[model samples]
Target: EQKKNITYVLNGTTQIQSYVKQLIDVTKSWNCSDVTYTTVRLEDFFADIKEQALGLVEIYHQKIDWKAEQSDKKVTIAYDPMFRAVMNVIQNAVEHTKENGIIYIDAKEQDGRLTFIVEDSGSGFTKEALLHGTEQFFMDDTSRNGEAHYGMGLFFAKTVAEKYGGGIKLSNSENTGGARVEIFFLSSQETS
Candidate 1:
């Protein structure tokens, strides 16, 4: 009789623990999905502000060691959520840049579409790093002066750009030997 009661209590406790673990796993997956969605929206909105700030810095030349150029037509798009995506790229550049490093923001129309470029005077990625850089949560093994980098910036940036019917490209600058991130946006009429 006592043995039977003990067995019942043990089984109940085991079942409860199993249920709790399953709930936690589901919650984590949902949180990841939410973060991805929110980050995409934020990026779309921030891209414009980034362009504007770069423009103002070019015109004033006050604290403007960097140079940015944009097309005259001013291709505009409705950005739903604008914070995370844009900031990730900008923050990466700022983090890698040395004091007085030159950053360039340029926009141009090519093949009837608009493209935005962010170039920074910082150590560019190596071939191996660049190849795998877009993977989620990929951090470069090389550290520069103890700088903290999680390696998720480019991944998130690319995600946001694609969500808005655009894409991101990464390369090294031939002129400045720095890093360049080009965002390509097709006109609404063009097929993705």
Candidate 2:
């Protein structure tokens, strides 16, 4: 039993290490302000993102209940960066949320705007995390050795949002009484 538990923890640690490497690669290549944007239909985009998020859920070994709608509406944005940014938020939730905690995602678009909200049933953000959570390398004191987190997840996500005239907000989820993050974009319309 000890061996199995050790192996499980090691596997989880390996997965996090891999993702951290991916995050580093993203930062090295990110030029969010100048990246090329792609226009995609909402339904297709949602489908693709949902699949990726689910993959993260499995990798992190957590159960998440996804809640999002389909739309024929169109959005023009940087696909890779935006996708990674959204995933970062979801990944943060997966990491901080307890082993059996429930995570929730709500994706939506309205009148040329798009938003992705992530919520969790874990201990929500600290008082400090709420104010400067999106700042680079702003990990809380409780962070493990400051190695597991460089505090770039939400920071990168917020940067991507601003690149496309959007923004991000960190708050406590009233319903779940846990951390909630909303990444949103505005004026994402294409001209005919």
How many pairs in model 1 have backbone atoms within 3 A of each other, for residues 3 or more apart or on separate chains, i.e. clashes? 7
TM-score of each: 0.58, 0.80
Q: What C-alpha lDDT values do all the predictions have?
A: 0.56, 0.79
Q: 48, model 2: CA deviation in Å? A: 1.4
| Each model's backbone clash number | 7, 0
Cα lDDT tens digits for candidate 1, 1-192? 999999999988886675565344334433434433221222333355566556544443422233333333333443322234444565666666676567666645556444667677778767866687766656677743256455566776676567556778888888668777877555432232
Query: Could you give candidate 2's per-residue lDDT for residues 76-162 as a string of tens digits?
Result: 877777787788888888887766678899988878778899998877888899999999768898652234666678888887777
Best by TM-score: 2
Model 1 ranges off by over 4 Å: 1-76, 80-84, 109-112, 189-192
Model 1: how far residue 175 lies from native, Å: 1.0
Most lDDT-accurate candidate: 2
